[model samples]
Target: MGDITGDTRLQSRILEDVGAASHYRAWLVSLALDALGDEPVEIGSGHGDYAAEWLPHARSFTATDADESRVAFLKERFAGDSRVRVRKLLLPSTLDGGFSSAVAYNVLEHIPDDVAALRSMAAMVRPGGAVIVFVPAFPLLMSDFDRAVGHVRRYRRASLRKAFEDAGLRPRVLKHVNWAGFFAWLLMMRLLRGVPRDSLALRTYDRLIVPAVRASERLMAPPFGQSLLAIADV
Candidate 1:
């Protein structure tokens, strides 16, 4: 892992915090999982946090990442799990396709050419299969946090639809999520200048605020949010 980036402590911290804010992220991951087919391939599976949730549902779950270090970590993490296979696959590469579904969570923004990346995801899936993606929403919310995480850009509903369309996929579901988190992000990252290190406040937001908005978002799609979830058929 040090080969990719010399900062081992940062890597360790990131892995440790993989699913800390699980209330909202788990909901999003579950939504993506339910949309997948039997043979689903999860691309850019960082730390295998969310991937672990859906692996049992997939008849053949191939967890892939372009980063060799991340793939190695995933392999070791799931060493005894026969249902999952971890592979090092750079996107838009010439590997065997014909998968039932392709999933990418919080990854499209990292790619400089997201449209091409989406095209590759669609190409990997078999016809009639779908490509599901979760991305940060609202370009206006592209804060220092996004840049710190190596995000090149954010996506709006129209822009997200256009990306899938440009990749030759038909958009079936596209909506804003984390409506409450949108305001929270604005307050913390923008107004407050990063989330305070106070653990109790963070827990309150995650345990209470997140679930409340998540349930409400299910009943009605919010006009704006901190993230977008899209399901596009190939």
Candidate 2:
């Protein structure tokens, strides 16, 4: 997550995909929300989707993005909401924004120096404040879609834990999510090497598959998953 500009075309397509995965997004965000305390800040808040969902829960929210167009969109999206503030910032940021929690979803993998970026997020918050994030899991799942979306690398449990520890953050919740998604990603993303576009198949999965997986995970955490959720203390 350097100061380098993002590929807007690629970003737009990915954001569209997020929009299509309604239940999927809701479940993922619900899990993330449980970890975030009040006065939360999000890094790389693409298209403000997460911010919109998270803002209602947080007393005050800060949403930052490195892309200029995304920043503008975020400003417009949250302009009427006084409790929300939007900023243009890249990872490894120096700003001490005085937030209780710093978060990012599917953002860390884009950073070549992810540990520095995590340290920067930790710096933005007060002591004992949390740094929460959700990132793609399993390097073997690295597909053309990941590259097309600007991912530098996917992560393992140990790798993510090490990153948190190296950044002086103690992991409070570091686990894999979406156990079934691991197989779906391996076949659709890795084997196929194609991006997930808006389609009936995606919506069907969101409707039928997501709920069952989420419920099962609540009962028992799986050994591995398609993604990793990490909540750490600064």
Candidate 3:
């Protein structure tokens, strides 16, 4: 229950209709979809984009977010879509039984109680079901941009795995992402500590920098850059 309703330039930049960010987000959703197979529940669904992406493959889909307005919008956006359902509920509180898989993209970092969140997700799914998460990587790399976006903390693979394990879930995959872009971000933003959030510089980075970095992800394995992905089972 962190106060994330802040108006910041960084929020505007990342949540805006930037193609590169959308592409990377979609790519991550695709990975979750592959792991989920024909049906899954999506937690922290912002605008329903991730659920929309999985609609064709998913037999049924449910999405929830703490933001009531966003949930209302999602409900309207998919009103007639029999495959989709949207609701407003806080994390782990809204989770319940029956889902075979769960997804929480770029979400764990925002919660103050990360371990509790993981445990709630574990309790929601069937014993053998999967829970996949994506979050910003490396606590040392935390910046104002993270704060603006309401991130309580960044994570390393081991720490994230520990959280899941402590919640009675078994880690299946945990890795870093956007490796090539990590140094660039560090140099331009973290080290310099001068890059303004949502500036032209950031836009340029998203356009030019992200494509190159995403291309490199295919060549490398997990533990790549500044973002982490973890998949665990209940």
Candidate 4:
């Protein structure tokens, strides 16, 4: 909805974080790819990062996004890789019941009609196929950063589960993540009432604080932190 694709600084920071999280990203990709099995289509494939990650595992990959520039970038980036294809697509209509599974990571919150979007994602998948989603959690933790990025809502497990159910999908897993970081974000939003402007401070927090919190995730479970992850079957 916003010109987020032009925010090079935010995009760089996000991609850097994704690349650094070998364990977490691998886990997420594994879940989605496993659900997909030999499926060949991917929905909302912004920048094709996840598509690249899952390419080796999938039989073929058709990456689609609403953003035409992103689609062109992905097409050029994966041009030599014949197994991957990129195209511009709107939800529900463009999807039109073609994919074996659909993945909408960190995308749903950006849409106002989150439930309808989930249904559209579900429609893309064939029967028995899955939809994997990731969203920031806790309304109390929503911040200026979220507003800038065009997030319509944050989520809790119950709300997330209900959303999937409303979309006619069966929720397989709905859990909270980033437990340690949750407290930090909560404090920042609820108490500080503003986002920190220091890039160095943010980097230090991500590099140092994230690992410690993620390590704690092994012991602690849902309702822990600031993210909600879900896998649902259509």
C-alpha lDDT of all candidate models, in order: 0.78, 0.88, 0.73, 0.71
Please estimate how well model 2 matches the true structure, expressed as its whole-model Cα lDDT: 0.88
Query: Which tens-of-lDDT digit does each residue in 36-86 have in candidate 4?
Result: 755656766777777889888887778877666667778898999888778
lDDT of 3 by residue, 149-216 (tens): 78788888888988888887777888888786578667765877653445566667776776777777
Leading candidate by lDDT: 2
Candidate with the larger lDDT of 2 and 4: 2
Q: How many backbone clashes does every candidate have?
A: 0, 1, 3, 0
TM-score of 1: 0.90
* Off by more than 4 A, model 4: 1-24, 92-94, 187-220
Question: Can you rank all candidates by TM-score, best first?
Answer: 2, 1, 3, 4
Please provide, for model 1 over 1-234, each residue's C-alpha lDDT reduced to its tens digit, 9 standing for 90 to 100: 111212333433555554577775678777886679998888878688877888777887889876767889899999998888889876665655688898988778877777888888887889889999989888877777667666678899999999888888878889888888788778777666673233667767788888888888778989988899899877
- lDDT for residue 196 in candidate 4, whole number 0-100: 42
TM-score: model 2 vs. ground truth: 0.96
Check candidate 1 and list the clashing pairs.
none
Give the Å shift of residue 227 in candidate 3. 0.5
- Top of the candidates by TM-score: 2
Give per-residue lDDT, candidate 2, residue 205: 91
Model 1 residue 158 CA deviation in Å = 1.3
* Candidate 3 stretches greater than 4 Å from native: 1-13, 17-20, 188-212
